[model samples]
Target: MANERWNLNTTSDLTAEPGTPVGLVNQPRTAAQRLTDRPSDYGEQIVPPKPLWYLDKAGEPHSLGVNEPHQFLLFWRSNVGDKAADLDDSYYMGVTGLQGVGVAGHRVTINATGEVLQPGGESSATISGFWDKSDPDDPMWTPIEPETEYTVTVAAHNQSGEFGPDSDELTITTPAVGYDTQQLTLPPRPPNDVDFAAPLPVITTSGGGGIQLRWTTVPNVTKYEIFDNPTPGTTDGMDSSRPGLNSRDVKLGEVNQPSAGTPTVTFTTPAYTTPRRRFALKVRAVRTNSYGTAYSEFSTPLRGALPASTVAPGTPGAPTLTVSPVVGGQVKLTISPPTINASNGAPEYYAVYDGTRQVAVVSSPLGAAPHVTLQYAAAQGYSFTVAAGNSVGVSNPSSALTGTVPTPAAPGAPTAVAVTNVTTTGLAVNWTAPASANPPVTSYKVYDGSTVKATVAAPATTTNLTGYSPQTAYSIQVAAVNGTGEGSKSSPAVTGTTPAT
Candidate 1:
């Protein structure tokens, strides 16, 4: 019994050890027993290992170009040991100008998590920032001067609240600030009714019949040059390099540092003489860099006309208006213009008005049908009027036409979808009613991803889908459908496994 160990949970007879009862004195614990008695004091504290970091330009560590000298992406790999805890705490990254191994220069701290630290918070492994020399007062976490060298490093605390060692340092140099070399493309032209165009631009004649032009903005562009083809029906090829108006075109005007919102310019038209005049307009973008200025291609040409008349046109005949339903709560209004006559100045153009508000103006070389689409809310009614116009003035409004927009309730996505039953060859599914069932949901579509499995009628919440393989998993979703079309599918697809035969 000298070398035997006793279990603390069991009752042992002292007399079993022959002479143990005679002395009954305690003996020193063995080395193994002493080691097991204080387990917490033997191990080292768990702390995250230092991270290994690298700096790169667009993922290339050694090939930073002149244009990307200042821009860099910092990346690192975790240096976690077997006993180290998971990295679940906020980590800090920093960059500083370096002169020598121990020399200090400008320094800035960047949060690798892209968020401010809070107690018990975690963040992403990567973050991006830039240094600007031009604006020292700019509000940024770590602003660096251009054309300067800097070193980057990272560190983070372990779950045990111990800060790990800093990652290996990476050095980088900032590039000079300048314009991008890529050519600026032409800006998208404003929507206009010039024919076969996706967006039609709206033109309104201002006081004194001046023409105001409007268009959308282009990215990375600071200037715009407007060109006009004075001669009707002729194409004038214009670009940034050849912005000058050709023999048949004229450089109307230029806009510098266009505003962020809608861009526009106005031109004064000559006094109306006798007949009507037509003009084609186009616009191009301009960008200036250190090298020089570059231009984009000209946008699609927009056609507009100016009428000449000293007398107002005669009142237009009662327009024959037809209303047709269209998508997105809109109705198309088709107006048949009156026959051209000397009294109406040949019906140069027509104006469509919604109540007292002018909705659209359409040019008509001669009497023709002009169609306009107006947006309306559900159950909303609109009254429209048409007026013929010449260079002199607009004629009296025609008789009013009224129409009502249709209300179609499009069902929302189904909710609380779950699997009801599963068989080797078939699966059953059910869902709750959609939040919205305007016009009432007529049917429901059961989908496995994009593929439709079955169509179930309304008032029914369950459907058994067939043709599925045995011992297989299926992710299913349900969608409600009404006259407006199928609604979005339910989120968090419910998965079901079929029983094997």
Candidate 2:
């Protein structure tokens, strides 16, 4: 097909030709017509909106104490006409720099975007990216000095990568460390007077065997530091070489300036069992102001001993004794321990007494049963008592108990039987009871050779046998009688010779 040109003037006329070549009729239009026909070309470069300002904490500007950190909050509209669809690509906020205005002035960049000129082309000063508030991590500026004025500004970038106008500067100042130099005076040290009235360095018994200490307050003192030592005179002769005279001493605690109606500060001693723990205490007063802190010299060392707790275990209950059968001339005794005092501490041990004398000491009452074995004769009786003891002291003795040694079989022969008070016609015989008598001897029988001489009641140490020939020697023997019957005669009969006139 041969190419031919068609002169179609308007879009309507060009569409009317059916067999006309589409490419020939379709031709590029002039720039002016294209510009007029196109969507009017109303688009322009986007500019970031100005940011609204606020303090990081309180909405209004506030004073910062010495060493306080400065922070701010800046927020702006990120959307532009056509760029509003791309929020992440459209805009970003930056803190330019903090400028200190006047004497002792300086400048520090808080946020930057790598631009050689100032951020947002606002200033010619150098910039930095040391801190960025938009960053979640490490989002704080370098702290400023107290008593200084600063102007903080922020800039925003649009999708075209161009920073718009800077936000209005916010002026702030950190507060000064305010105090009157003259008011910073050292407080007077506590007095060394041992007689400084009650409640001042007063020592009292604390609950659970401890000591409590209290002291009066000094005027204009903001804090009081206390020192304590086990040795007396430790605070004496302290030189400048030892800056803190009581440096060796332990610091108990500090007392801050008390509120109204509270006149004294008290320290309760820790729970301890050591009796009479002598403590040397010294107190120094301190005050702080713009001139700094001042400490007074340590007061005179006051010594006091910790008193024992007044609460004590109650008296022990009566003890019971159980005697065992005698074996080999000895008897065994088992004692039941006493009950403990519920209101106070338990006893340390028990004192076992035989009559008025303390015979043994049982260290633990709740441990093994208090078992004791003692050598005893059948005729002898024993009395026992018990008393509880503790760190404080011993308690009163419990009720007394009486026991006797047990014996088996008949009574044994009497011992130490002899003849005394010899005369011309008569002589007296003296004897003692058997050592191991089960039923206990009721009477005694005296014999002259093979003939029964006389009978006497039991426990009769002396007996007279008259009608004896003078200058004659007679053989005599004694026998013990019990409820069962008479026991064997005494061995080795004693020979008695009466003197002739």
Candidate 3:
């Protein structure tokens, strides 16, 4: 062998310096001097002494390092803020401990070209020659060939290449073309599953909420971007652009090479707030490569939320809130007759509540009985109950029911009324609130024509029924009631359907 074939696995007792780009005078070190395996003399230019961490190979601290900005001037000034940018220029790597010996020969074999460069080539420079560590301005030149393989070797003049040995030939070549950077191009990379939150689900009167999220597992990706838009409201990430990039469509902290698939994340909401809320999401894969390759991108089509929060099977029951339901802006329910004196001939008022929220309070000074014809309005399938509140104590909530109160009845025949605007869970039934004689009509009844479908024990009109079979029809009718008793069934029947699957 021309040189010593030393398989030196033994770590060098000579400590190597750690490299951190600091008051770097912009002087560059050659790639081979990266000290990745073993620390060699890392050639650094005279930079204004600032805070710098001096370390040995393997990242061990050789000593406490605090390079204060010294009398030296800052080099190659440029815009400074978040990231350290490199200036455009050619840099050289230097040698140390050369003492009296000189680099007698040097050679670099290129992979693709198969050509070699030595001491003096038009493109390559002799990195090793008469080594001198004395001058701070000492410079060394090395050469590089594109898309090629290279094996480099250096030796001294005093010895016939018997001491220091040669390095493994690094067959330099462009990464395997068209490799799925996510798969083949590099070492086995860890998967990057971008940032994700609880998905926006299709809320249903059915109890459980729906949630869908944006996700991907990519290789070499740094940040995974997730954002959403609520169909009924606004999507989660809908606030900014999808993947939330800037004018450059480059979002910060995004990852690259995400794995395939749009995943879902679930979360629960308080049952009563109607599915009036909805959303959509976008997730992206990002990669910041050492080679500065373009970032990879992927987006998804918009998704919708399912409606929930509506009236239940029973109207005058628990879990239901009687909201005015007219949709001006936000209708807050305020109590009336502040302090009802039922004992002083004042009529007892009936109230509707939303999950303990009191919306409407109704009572007449004339001491009117509970209205059978009036229907309290609520969302389609949420639980609700009506309480006859007086000046005294409050009453227990009625059974849990979903939907609005039924309409009043006509004195004559109630005809077949058709229903529309069907949702997955509930329906709207409209009919006449039955007629009254002497005093006034209050309570009302809606039946599947056989059994009482739903009843309004207090004064109200128009009810939304929840928890119904989807796309199914039901024969419905409304009747009147008062303290007297149940009135005759309405003449005509009405029908409505639940949402189709």
* Leading candidate by TM-score: 1
Give each model a TM-score. Answer: 0.29, 0.25, 0.24
Count clashing residue pairs per candidate. 9, 0, 84
Query: Per-residue lDDT of 1-501 in model 3, one digit per residue for the tens?
Result: 122111122212222322322232233332233233332332321111111112234542221211111111111111111122232222211122222223333333223222223332111232222222244366333233234333322212212322223323332232233334324324333223432355444322223343434333454454444434333342323225433343223222232333345333222223212233343444554444665433344455344544432222112223322243422222233222222222221223567665577655654322123322223343323344565443333444555444443333223322344455568777676655444422245567777758776787545655676667777777766766654456666655655555579
Who is ahead in TM-score, 2 or 3?
2
lDDT of each: 0.56, 0.54, 0.37
| Tens digit of per-residue lDDT, candidate 2, span 322-342 | 434444356565655444434
Instruction: State the lDDT of candidate 1 residue by residue for 1-501, as single tens digits.
Output: 443334221223232433343333356443234334524533432333454443343443321123343354443434334222223312222212111111111122332312222222222222235343344466445544567676555555533234445555556666565334333322333323213222222222221233555555666666777666768665645445544446666777777755666544333333222235666777777777554666766778877665465456665554443534433466677766654344545456779888999988876434346677777788887788889786578788988877676687678898899887688888788899886565568899999877899999998988988998888888899999887788889999988688888
In model 3, how large is the Cα lDDT of residue 272?
A: 18
Total backbone clashes of model 1?
Answer: 9
The residue ranges of model 2 lying beyond 4 angstroms of the native Cα positions read 1-188, 191-215, 233-242, 260-273, 309-501
lDDT of candidate 2 at residue 451, scale 0 to 100: 85
Q: How close to the true structure is residue 355 of candidate 3, measured as C-alpha lDDT?
A: 56
lDDT winner: 1
Which residue ranges in model 1 land beyond 4 Å of their true spot? 1-275, 278-311, 314-323, 411-444, 447-467, 471-501
Error of 2 at 427 (Å): 99
Q: Give the TM-score of candidate 2.
A: 0.25
Model 2 poorest 10 in a row by lDDT: 98-107
Q: Is candidate 2 or candidate 3 better by lDDT?
A: 2
